[model samples]
Target: MLIITPQELQTDRLVNQLAKTWQEHGLDLETMLKTLREVRSEYTP
Candidate 1:
C-alpha cells in the first residue's frame, strides 16, 4: 500500500492540468523533441 499527502495530491493535479493545457495548445511530442534539439545545439560545447 502507498500513501499520498495532500500537497503531493495537489501537485499531481496541477501537473495534470498543465499537461492538458499543453495538449490543447498542440504541444505534441514532435514539437517538444524539435525544441529540445534546437536548445541543445545552442548550448552544447
Candidate 2:
C-alpha cells in the first residue's frame, strides 16, 4: 500500500514550478544536475 501526504503533494508542486522556471530561463537537465552536484560538494566538506 502507498499513501501520499499533503506535504508531499505540495513539495511536488513546488518542484514542478522550479523545473518550469528553470526551463523558461533556458536551463537544461544536464546543466541543472551538474550545478546541483557542485553545490552539494561545496557544502559537504
Candidate 3:
C-alpha cells in the first residue's frame, strides 16, 4: 500500500519541468545531484 500527498505531486511536476530544461541544456538528474552534493559539502564545516 502506497500513498502520495498533494505536495509530493506538485514536487514531482516541478522536477519534471526542471528535468526537461536540464536536458535541453545538456545536463541530467545524476549530474544535478552530484553538483548539489559537491556544493553542499563545500558549505559544510
Highest TM-score: give the candidate number: 3
- Backbone clashes for every candidate come to 0, 0, 0
Q: State which candidate, 1 or 3, has the greater lDDT.
A: 3
Model 2 Cα lDDT, one tens digit per residue, 1-45:
999675557889898999999899999889989999999999997
lDDT of 3 by residue, 1-45 (tens): 899665557889998999899999999988989999999999999
Residue lDDT tens for model 1, 1-45 = 999675557889887987888799989767888999999999999
How does each model score on lDDT?
0.85, 0.90, 0.91
Pairs that clash in candidate 3: none
Candidate 2: which stretches are off by over 4 Å? 1-8, 39-45
Please give the range of 10 consecutive residues that has the lowest summed lDDT in model 3: 4-13
**Root-mean-square deviation of candidate 3:** 6.1
Model 1 bad stretches (over 4 Å): 1-18
Q: Candidate 2: worst 10 consecutive residues by lDDT?
A: 4-13
Per-candidate TM-scores read 0.49, 0.54, 0.65
- Report lDDT (Cα) of residue 19, candidate 1: 82
